[model samples]
Target chain A: MKALVWHGKEDIRCDTVTDPEIQDPRDAIIKVTSCAICGSDLHLFHNFIPGMLPGDIMGHETMGEVVEVGSGVNGKLKKGDRVVVPFTIICGECEQCKRGNFSVCETTNRKRHLADKVFGHTTAGLFGYTHLTGGYPGGQAEYLRVPFADATHIKVPAGIPDEQLLFLSDIFPTGWQAAAQCDIEPTDTVAIWGCGPVGQMAIRSAILLGANRVIAIDCLPERLSMAEAGGATTINFETESVVERLQELTDGRGPEKCIDCVGMEAHVMPSLPDTLLDRAKQMVMAESDRPHVLREMIYVCRPGGIISVPGVYSGLSDMLPMGAFMNKGLTMRTGQTHVNRWTDDLLRRIEEGEIDPSFVITHTVPLAQGPEMYQVFRDKRESCVKVVLKP
Target chain B: MFHFSNIVRTKGDPEIVKGGPSLKQPADQLARALGWFSIGLGVVELFAPRRVTETLGMEGRETMVRAFGVREIMSGIMSLSVDKNAGLWTRVGGDGLDAAALLSGLTSDNPKKGNIALALLMVGGIAVLDYRAAQDTKPRRPPRDARRKLYPNRSGFPKGIESVRTAARQIAAHAKTHLKTHAETNEVKQGDERRVP
Candidate 1:
C-alpha cells in the first residue's frame, strides 16, 4: 500500500509500502479512512524526537474500518467495525491501564530499558512515533496494524463521518484531558497558549467544562479567530505581551489555570540572546526541547493555580524559574493524554451535538499530496490549521 | 460488534506488529547500570561525606567531596531523563569533572594515594562505558536520497495506475456493508445506531 515515508528532517515522501496485517493475537488491521497531520508530527519532521530512522511511516491521528481482527480480540472487535484507534497502544490489563493511566502502560514497550534509562520508566506503545515508542506503522497509509484492538480502539457509529470522529484518536481527548487536569470550577478563568488544533480543541473543552473566561493566545489571525469561535478571548502574542495582555484581560488577576499546548519546538521571536540563543542551542543539541512557552506559563500563571500542559516535552531544556515555582506554590500537571479514559465521555459529547470537532480541518487531500500539505500546514499557508488525508 | 461473512484480503504482505522494541544494546544496559552506580555513590557521599573523604584519603576535603556528590547525583538524574546519546555525553562530562577532583587529591599529600589511584581507575573504567554508550546512540546521518521512493502516477493501487483512494472505494463499498450490518447488530445491544447522528 502507499504510505508517507519520512526521509530526513523536512523531507517526507508518498511511497508504495507493504500493507499492514494483524501481527498480534490482540491486533487488528484497519483500512484507514481519515488521518490528520498532528502538530507533534512536526516534532518528528524537525528531527527533534530521537531515533527516527529512514523509511519510518509518520502519522497518528486516524480513524477507520476494521478489515480483520485476531482471535484474541474475540468478542470485542469484529471485522468491518468502524473504530478510532487511540495513538497510545495499551494491553488494558496492566496496572496503569487499570488505574486509567493507559498512556503509561508498561507491557507495550519492548524497549522499555531505553526509555527506562532516560525517563526512569517506559511509556505505552505509540504508532509511528520513534524507537522511543513501539514504532508501529502509522495511519498515514492505506492500512494500519492496530495492536490491543479490544482496548485501544473506540468504536464509533457508522453514521458519524470520519471527519468528526477521527480526532478521537488524539487531539479531542488530549484537549479534554488538559482541561480536565486543570480541575476547572464553573467560574474559573483559563488561559491557553498556542491556537493550534489542540489549543482550539482545548478552548472548546474548557468552555464545556464551565470555565468563565478562556483566553487564547497566538499571533495567527485565523487560529485566533477559530479560538474566538470556540468562545475564547483572543490574545495576539506578536503585537502584545502575553503576560501583560493576559493580566489586563483578567483585570490584574491572572487566569486561574494556564494551559501550554505548544510543546518542545515552540517558535521564539526575532529577539537576540533569548529566542535566537535557544534555537542555536537546540540546533547544536545543547537541549532536547525549547521551553519558551513553559517559561512564559510559569511567569504569567496566577499564583497558587494550576498550569495544565497538554504539550509534549522530551529530553531536557534549560532555565526554569524554580524560585517562582516554589514561592507561588504552583501545581503543574502534564502527560501524554490518557486517551482511552476520555473516549467514552468525549464521544458522547460529539454525538450529542454539543460540538463538532471537525470544524478545525482546513484542508483535505489525498495521501499522495501529504508531503506537500505538510509544508502548507507547517508554514501555516492557505490559512491551514489542520489537514486531513484520505488514503 | 461488527461482522462480515467474507474477509477481504488485500494485496502485499501483512506487516507483523513487533509489539515492542528489539533487545537493548549492551552499551545501553551498561549506561543504565552506570546511572544507578552514580546515584548509589552520590547517596553515600551526601550522607557520609566523612567516610567518602576518608576512603579517598583526602580527609580535609569533606566539603568539596560532598559538593562532588551533589554533582554526581545531578549527573545521574540527567543520565536517567534523556536519550542514550545525551545521557552518555553527560556521563562523559561528569567523568571529566571527577578526574579533575581526583587530580586535586593526587597533590593533597594524603595518606591513601593508592586509594586515589583506585578511584581514578574506577572513573577510567566507567568513562569507557560512557564513551561506548555515546558511540552506540550517536545520530547516523542518512544519505540524502535514502527513503525517497516515489511511485509516480501510481495512486497506492494494486493496479499501479489509478489513485489509491479511488481503488479503495471499489473494495470499500463491499466493506461498508459489513460495517453497516455490524452497526445495526451493535444497536441491538445499546440502541447505539439510533443515537448516531
Candidate 2:
C-alpha cells in the first residue's frame, strides 16, 4: 500500500510501503481515512529525532475504519467501525497499565508477545518511529496495523465528523493534558508559552477549566492572533520580554499557571532561533518540528504555580533553571498525554457540540498534496493554523 | 504550681518520669504548629518576605533553623508554648526564661530577617525528603503491556487465548444483537446512544 515514507533528512515522499496485516490476536488492520502533519512530524525533516532510516512511513495523528480485526480482538469493535488510534501503541495489561498507565505498556512493540525483557527500563511502543519505540509502522498508509486494538483505538461517535475525530489520535488529548496538568484554579491567571495549535488548544481548554484570564506568548503573529481569537490575551516575546510584561500584568507576581506548548524545538535564540527563516523552514516546512518553549514558560509563571509541558521532547533538555524552579516552589509536570483517558469525554463533548477543536484547521488538502502542505506549514505562512490531510 | 508528683506517679524510672507528659509528643505538635506558622509567614512573605525578616531582626537561614528548631524543642520540653500556666520546665529560672522568650521575641525582631531564617528552617525538612527520593537507586521501571490479559479470568479460555477469544465473542454478540434487532421489524428502536458503524 502507498504510505508517506520518511527517507532521510528533509526528505518525505509518498511511496509504496508494505501493506499492514493483523499479526496478533489483539491487533486490527485499519484503512486510513484522515491523517495530519503534527509539529513533531517536521523533526524527521530537520533530523531532530535520530535513527531516521529510509522507508519509514510518517504521520501518527490519524483516524480510520477497521478493515479487519484479529481473531482475539474484542471490545465488541468490528470490521468497518470508525476508530481513532492513539499514537502510542500499548498492551494495556502490564504493571504500568494495570495501574492505568497505558503509555508505557510492556508488550508494546512485540509482534506476538512482550519483548524478550524490556527496552531501556521503560518501553512504550509508538508508530513509524525507529528502534527507540520498537519501530511499529505508522498510519500514513492505505492500511496500517494497530496493536492492542482494544486499548489503543476508540470508536468515534457517529455524529462527529472524521476531521474532528482524527485529532483524537494525538493533538486533542495532548492539548487537554497540557491544560489539565497546569492545575489552574477558577479565575486564576494563566500564560501559555506557545501559541501553536497545541498551545491554542490549551488556551481554549484553560477557559473550559475556568481560568478567567489567559495570556499567550509566541513570536508568530498568526499564532498570537489565533490565541487572542481563542479568548486569550496575547504576548509577542519577540517584541517584549515575556517575564517583565507578565509581571507588569499580574501585579508583579506573574501568571498563576503556565503551560509549555512548545517543546524542545522552541523558537529561542542561538541554537534554537525563532528567526523567520528558521520558522519558515522548520515549523512551516519540516514534517517533524518541535521547538522548546520551556525558558519562556518558567520566566512568566508565578511562584508556587504549576507548569505543564506536553510538547514532545526526546533524550535531553537544556537551558532550564532548576534552582529558580526549586526556590520558587514550582510544580513541574512533563510527559506524553494519556490519550485513551480523555477520548471518551472529548468524544462526548464533540458529539454534544460543546467544543470544536477543529477550529485550528485552516487548511485541508488532498492526501496527495501532503508534500506541498508540509512546505506551506513549515513556511509559517500568516494564514496557517493547522493542516488536515484528507485521504 | 501543679507539681509532677501531685498529679501521677512516675513509673519508667526515677530520672525518666513516665507519669508526667514528656516533651516528644509536645515537640512534634510544636513542630507541626511551626510548619503552619511558617506558611503564614510565607503568605506575608509573598507580599514581603524581606519586610517580615527585617521587622523580626533575626539571623539568616542558619540562625532561623536553629531558632525554630530550638523553639519547637523548648515548646515540647517545657509545654510552656501550649499553656503559659504550666511552667514546670521554667523552674530553671533565667535559662528557662530566655528560652521562653523566643516566640514572643518574633514580633519584636525585624520581620524581614526573622522570616528569612524561619522560612529556611520550615522548608528544610521537606527539601531533604524530596532530595532523598531523587537520589533513589531503584532501576528505572520498565513500561507495561496490556494485551496479555484482556479477558476476565472466570471465562474458560487459556490465559494466552482469553483476550482474543473474549474480544471475538464480544464482537460476535454485538453483531448478533444488531442483526436480531434489525430482523425483528415490529420491535421499537430506541436511539442507540453509542452509535457505531
Candidate 3:
C-alpha cells in the first residue's frame, strides 16, 4: 500500500508500505477512497507538534469502503459498508464517550502514559497524528486499519459524492462545533479569525446558525473571497485593522462571539509585533504555540461574551491577556471536536442540501501527488484553499 | 530511520516497504545543509574566538569574532526554520560583512594576508550559494497584489443563502415561541399551587 509518510520538517514522501492487519477483534480494514490535507497537517509537516516520528503516515480526513471487518464489529459494520472514519478513535463504552466527549475517550489511546504526562490526561487516539495519540497509521494511504471501527466510523449511504461526505471525518463537524459552541444568537455578531478551510466552514456554520453578522478575518484574497461567498463580511488584516474594522462593524461593542481558527502558527508580520515576538520565541523553543489569534480574540471580543476555539494548539503559549479575560467575565471554550456528537446532525444537514463542504476544496489530485500537494497547500499557491487526495 | 521508526510500531501497523522521492526540493536540501554548516561554524567561532582570530591574523578582534558568531547562529536557526529564506538572506548580508572584514585584514603589514584572502574566497563562494538558496527557497505564494480568482458563488448552500437565512429565522422564531409557551405554562402551574394552598 502506498502512503504519505512524514520524514522531518517540510518532508513527506509517498512510500510503498506494508499492508495493515487487524490486530484486535474490533479492528476493520478499509480501502480508502478519499483523504485530505488539513490545515493542522501543516503543523506536523513543519515539525511543530512533537511526538511525530519519521515514517508515521500523514492524514486524518478519510472515507472509504470497508473491505474487511472484525467479529467484534458484529452486525453494526460489515464488508462493503461505506464510512467516513472520524479522526479520533473512540471506544463507545467509555465514560467520556457516554457523555459525548468522544475526543477524550478513555479507552482508545494506546500511548496514554505519554499523553497523561503532557496533557494531564489522555485524549482519544487520532489517526496519523503522533505517538502521544497512539501513533495509529493514518488514512492517507491505499488502505487503513481502523481500530474500534464499529464505533469510530460514520456510516454514509450511497448516492453522495466522496467530496460531499469526506469532510465529515473532520473539518465539517469541526467547523460546526466551533460555531455551535458559540451558542450563536440571531442578534450576535460573530468574528472569526483565519479564512482557511475550517474558517470558511465556520463562516457558513455561523450564518446557518443565525448569527446576525459573520465577520471573517484573513490576509489572503482568495480565502476572503470564499468567506464572502459564505455570507461573511470579510476583513483583510493585511490591509485593514481587524480590531478597528470589527469594532466599526459591531458599533464599538466588539463582536459578541469570537472564534480563533488560527492556532500555533499565526502569520508573522512586522506590522504585528506580537506575532513577530511569538515567532522568535517559537524558533528558540521557548514557546510551543503562536497565540496571536488568542490574544486578539480576547482583546477584541465583547465583554462577557464567548470565545470559541476549534483550532489545534499544541503546547504552552506566552503573554496571553488573562487580565482582560478575567476582568471582562468572558467565557472560553476549546477542544478537539467530539466528532460523533455532531456528525449525525451535520450529515442530515448535508443530505438536506443546507451546505456542501466540497466548496472549500480547490485542489484534488491522486494519492501519488500527495507530496506535491502538501507543498502547494502549505505555500497557499495557486490560490489553494483545500486539497483532497484521491487514494 | 524507517527501521528505527518501525521498532516503535505495534505488530499490526504498516511499516515502510520502500521509500519514494521526498517532497523537499533541491534548494530546500541546500538550505538545510547550509543551515547546519552555519551553526557548526558559529559554534567554533563562538567558543574558540581566539582560534578563529589567530587563523585570520586578527588576534585582537576576538570580541568582534564572537559577535559575528552570534549573528551566524541566529541566521542558522532561522534558516533551519520554516522561514529559511529569511535566514539565507541574513547569511548573505553576513557574508558581505565577512568579506569586508577579511579585506581590512589584507593589509601589507599583516603576516596572514594569504589566509585572509583564502577566507575571502570561501566567503564569496558561500555567499553565492546563500543567495541562490535564498531566492529558491522564497515562498511560491502568488503576489498579494496579483489578480486573484474570487469565489463569489460558492456559498456552500445548495438551497441558496436567502433560503437558508429564512430557515434559520423560522427556527429561531419557533424556539422563541416554544420558550414563551413553556414560561406561560410554568406561571400557570405556580398560580394553581398558590390557589390550592
State which candidate has the highest TM-score. 3
lDDT winner between 1 and 2, please give it. 1
Tens-place lDDT per residue, model 1, A33-133, is 99999999988876789967666788888888998999899779998889998999989999999999999999887568777887899999888887678
- Candidate 3 per-residue lDDT over residues B18-135, each given as its tens digit: 9989877899999999999999999998999999999888889999999999999999999999989989999999999999988888999999889998999999999999999999
- List ranges where model 2 is wrong by over 4 Å: A111-120, A268-292, B1-197
Q: What are the runs in model 1 whose C-alpha is more than 4 Å off?
A: B1-197
| Minimal lDDT window, size 10, model 2 chain A | A111-120
Q: Please give the TM-score of chain B in predicted model 2.
A: 0.23
Clashing pairs in 3: none
What TM-scores does chain A show, candidate by candidate in order? 0.98, 0.90, 0.99
Give the local distance difference test score of model 3: 0.93
Candidate 2 per-residue lDDT over residues A1-391, each given as its tens digit: 6666665544566654446666779888888888888887875655677555555567788888998988878655699898988988867777877775666676785432323333245567777765466656677666778878877788886766887778888888888888877876655898888777788778767766667688888876657666776667888876787778888888998888888877756663553354333333432224234334565566567888888888776554444667778888989887777778788888876776556777677788777667666656765653566888876
Q: By TM-score, is 2 or 3 better? A: 3
Fnat, model by model in order, equals 0.04, 0.00, 0.88
Candidate maximizing lDDT: 3
**How big a share of the true inter-chain contacts is recovered in candidate 3?**
0.88
